[model samples]
Target: MSAFVHPDEIRSRFSAALSAMYRAEVPQYGELLALVSEVNSRVLKADPTGAERLAAAGELARLSEERHGAIRVGTADELATIARAFAVMGMAPVSYYNLAPAGVPVHSTAFRPVEPAALARNPFRVFCSLLRLELIEDEALRAEAAAALARRDIFTPCARTLIETAETAGGLDEDQADRFVSELLETFRWHAQATVSAQTYERLVAAHRLIADVVSFKGPHINHLTPRTLDIDAAQAAMPERGITPKETIEGPPARACPILLRQTSFKALEEAIAFPSGDAVVAGVHTARFGEIEQRGCALTPTGRALYDTALATRDFAALPDDWTALRRNGLAWFRYRATPQGLAARAETADLEDLIALGHVVAEPITYEDFLPVSAAGIFQSNLGAEARGTAYAVDPAKADFEQALGRLVLDEMALYQAEQDASVAATLKALGLTTATA
Candidate 1:
């Protein structure tokens, strides 16, 4: 019998295969390839071992090609439909992120399944969206859009069948998978036909073709197959050096190395020639679909760490930002106790807040990990890159809480009860397998 490939390996293969398919559909993905290579080289030089923790250097480079991609949808039905498509790519909806919380000024949710093993192999991820378009509207135009969406079927019969079969068996065979990809492309191509004008439609088609051909043909989009810079200010300043026009900067906190969770800004999407008007006609306009994005990464803090960070932000003077508040945190000394089990929480509860909390107090503060994304930052980048755009309503939403284990069970399609039983059995089996215990507990 074949050796049992670890779950990590399985996830790696899944990401790789899907990335290749996406590249085939989007062709102009060269920029992504180049950007990732640059980031990898820098990461290697800075800390080889650290970079290898989440992924090996070789895997990071490969996943860079498949990186991640973003998509926008209008409704729950559309969101669920796309979720089915992602399953074929071996992805699951792991976390629900509220875009509005990051100050994007809109109501949006992002789903990401960053499986540790898959990430280790190649951190390919997709950020798909379902916008609350109705809330912020031109009522008449929105009515028209709603009608159009109602009339359309986002997935074809073949695609739907493939999704259903795959959901049952966990995946598709080679032949069925190929057919599903072809049918999905065809469906999207058909949808592109509904743009404002033939020229607009053709432009959209070309853009999708570029993404499909350049990025996914080689595999599903690598974690995100695009240029990612650690320093946006420097990248923006240097854009003219590479003959690329720099877009406006999305302002962020001016800390030297703080992990500004998700501050993204991009150049306007430029135009390219596309055949339209039913004949071999050319359209002259820039496409704002592609843009440059940069991010600053920081320590991943525990929940306590995040809460502490928020409190600091609210209480600290704006001028001090992170610097001035260092003293306050140190003097107050309110840090997290790492082990968060019931016993741990109870033990740590005795030392509440900064004034009474101290390091020797047996409490270790978890680093404040980034929990918010700058949506305006994201949209600014999106808007900067595109020529034409649409507006949508924004609303405040109480964030939803997700228990991680439940997400994992859903992603793997295993019953929670079964998984727990298997885990128990495994523990006992390992003891016996190692001859540390008898068959009977």
Candidate 2:
């Protein structure tokens, strides 16, 4: 057997390739990346301490390279194949998100690197959504959409071959991995020709714009590729200056000194030309979907803290959730990664008083970066792109997470458990390094 390429390297290469493709397909996305780069540089230059802290935590490098894209599939096979494709690249599905409550007829999950090392290497993520055909009110349109979706195979034969090769053989060699990236890239490539006729397309659009998008295309082209920014507020403001029009409101929690969770803003999706089948002739029309997005990430909150955040989000009163990092840690509202300071290692402190140690410069606690999405925020972005018609609950939705997972061929991993485990491991390692016992520290 040939030597296998590491999944992280494969993922990094794939991310770079995907970014290049998106830039060429959507020129504005390239502009968005440059704008994010500018804002991040400006923020880092103004805050040297923050820059140094980011560098120490191994975040500075990844911040610029990090990019997440979104894609929606029409069938269970497409979703399951996408899951397998990502698995070969060391990514796993995490946190099922029900968007029906937000009026979008889809449940979703984020496919991302699960481990800390792989994440630090390249935290590439894809917000994969599966269209809920049952939510389509028009029975005839729903049946047509399902039949059209069933007829299409999103993955290429080569991609399928490589996925199976990777599974049975344990991993792919360098040549296979390179080929895998290219073959997988084909699955996300944009096609302007619609599979359905103009009349069918009109019906699907009338039913819901998203259904048309998922069913009319040759493949589930990535809708948006988002880059991380140190300052999303600045990025949002700078969009217009860069000849981009951003959404009216940013998604997720509002701006804060110590940013919590994720705050995202995006330019409105572009309305591009599409060609639909019209008997012997092709009919030309317009379709809107792809866009560029930027995000600012902060600490992961504990369940208790998340509840407070939910309340604040519901009531539009953010003050109820304290903005101070220390207060958040003291109140057990957030997860933090602990490290023993040089001074603490020299002293070999026996005390497990984390607060006292922090005050004495013996220990440092850094917030664990949130690695999941907020369901409401995800829906807001999707809804904004699809327009008001997307918010119609005229079609009954059960929000069957189990059905979605059954289609996925596996259960989605719980993001909260992953974050908790990371924090627990960090604390144990930090305490051991400092020669102290963990007594509720």
Candidate 3:
């Protein structure tokens, strides 16, 4: 049996490998890192409190200095293949989210280590596979590409060997691990090099770039990663001073210290040069591919909090309400409430009424932690990083009816049953430790 890998160690190893993959694919990514460092420095020097909302300046220097990669696949089969490949790196599909019907173009998923500890250790991730709309005329291209992607397995025999060896061993011995990592990096580098002549490859690349050029992007090379920031207003104000012009901005609920889930705006994408078959040409362009996002994380609200969130979203009352997020934290009204102790006594000890709780010395409200990404914010970031403008939306799908579950099931090759079992076990362990009953009382 292979030795188990510590989750934190896995996080560290995976983050390094993924970052290398990104740099290899996007050389300009190095510039993005420098920009992030600059921004982090400025934010820390100016507003020390703001920096603490998510992480400390030094920690942000490490964790916040991350880049996420994005890709788009046409079908579930393609999605599955990519998922398996990422899994070899210790990633998993956490959420089933769809942005297809949203006004901005494209639909996709994010792959990463979902455990909160794993995220905290290193949240390096990819917003993998943004599927584009297939217009009637584009069906031929989509079909051919889909067929080709399904038939062609990107993970080679040797590549799979190294990956499986690494994964099953929970991580290779230092030398073997390093060798596998090298091989893995070489695989992606090889693709970027080998793609020169493959017609299928060219078609896919063109189609991928087309979405960036015409649909969602205004030009070419849309951003691969979009992050959620803690302060959109501050980030916006600070950008121009650093020579970055705000691409655009949007309104969210009146902000307070509490991190809102997602509010994003970014500086316009800078121009770049590309090589084409005809000749080398510089594309005078604007890219909506990169953006700055800020969020106020609320407590991991219980079902009640989610209901309140839904009510807030529906009424669009977050903006109109006089209650600041801090006020919510002060009161028991809008955050998650739970007992930290193993016994249920902590929950039971709280006074029943809010006023009574206040009088009875109960700590009714606690600030919710926000570490997860937001979808609307994600779509907004996607909109900002575009090479082309977004087409107007005609309709919104009832999420209940959307076939993303099955579609996604087809896209990933992992056994959901096994994944689910692992999740159940994790949950049961937590409940048992907390002295909660799993069976109906």
In candidate 2, list every pair of residues with a backbone clash.
none
The best-first sequence of candidates by lDDT reads 2, 3, 1
Each model's backbone clash number: 60, 0, 26
Best by TM-score: 2
**lDDT tens digits, residue span 1-441, model 1:** 223333333335544554454445444334433544565567557876655632422334443433445655544565666677665665566444445443232233344334433444544455554444433334654454455455556667888897787677666665666666666554333111222334333432333322221111111112222344554565555555545555656444444444434444444443433322344553333222434344543333334443555555556534433432244234332221121223333453443332233333422233222222334445544434433322232345554323222322343232223223433454344333333332221
lDDT of each residue in 159-263, candidate 2, tens digit only:
999999999999999999999999999989899999999889989888788888999989999999999999888899889999999999899998898889999
- What's model 3's lDDT at 216? 25
RMSD of candidate 1 to the true fold?
A: 10.1
Where is model 2 more than 4 Å wrong at Cα?
392-396
| True-vs-predicted CA distance for residue 387, candidate 1, Å | 6.9
Q: Give candidate 3 misplaced runs (Cα > 4 Å).
A: 1-4, 20-68, 88-90, 130-137, 147-158, 166-172, 179-222, 226-230, 250-254, 270-272, 275-316, 319-368, 393-403, 410-441
Better model by lDDT: candidate 2 vs candidate 3: 2
TM value for model 1: 0.58
- Cα distance off (Å), candidate 1, residue 280: 15
* Best-performing candidate as measured by lDDT: 2
- A best-first ranking of the candidates according to their TM-score comes to 2, 3, 1
